[model samples]
Target: MPQRLVAVSFNAPTSELAGRVTGQGATLRDIPGTLFLGGGVPVAVDGTSIAGIGVGGAPSGDLDEKYARAGLATIR
Candidate 1:
């Protein structure tokens, strides 16, 4: 599911699209760590999204997002 988020995020390169893909009854709700709310960030290069990094298992969703951002920074 995370991979799917990455793929959609890479293709559309927008947070709206990512969230839309995981909307209610959108087929990704059942997967664990497949949160569409936050914690998933698209990795772009030269204005093109190439990949994504997602962080899970954090105590809070905000922490998950923060860690994901940290991970993205490491590769940037």
Candidate 2:
């Protein structure tokens, strides 16, 4: 889900993309393939997104996102 989110975020808005995905009768967890809720964040270098990081096993999706952001911050 994070991977898909990052990919979609590259081309569209993450909030809107999430809404569209949910509107289509699918969830971040229910989507077929590698999908995650809020742990996936794109890694950008020099204003260019080159990769992404995904964190899991957190208590909540918000925590996962926070953790992922922390990790990205370290790299920056």
- Give candidate 1's whole-model lDDT: 0.60
TM-score of 2: 0.63
Clashes of each: 0, 4
lDDT of 2 by residue, 1-76 (tens): 4553564346332333455554545455365664535566777667666777667788976677678779879988
Find the 10 residues in a row with the least total lDDT in model 2: 7-16
Candidate 2: lDDT over CA atoms? 0.60
Query: Model 1: how far is 11 from its true place, Å?
Result: 7.2
Scanning candidate 1 in windows of ten residues, the lowest lDDT window is: 7-16
Taken over the whole model, the C-alpha lDDT of each candidate is: 0.60, 0.60
Q: Where does model 1 exceed 4 Å of error?
A: 3-34
Q: After superposition, how far is residue 49 of candidate 1 from its true place, in Å?
A: 0.8
lDDT of 2 at 2: 55
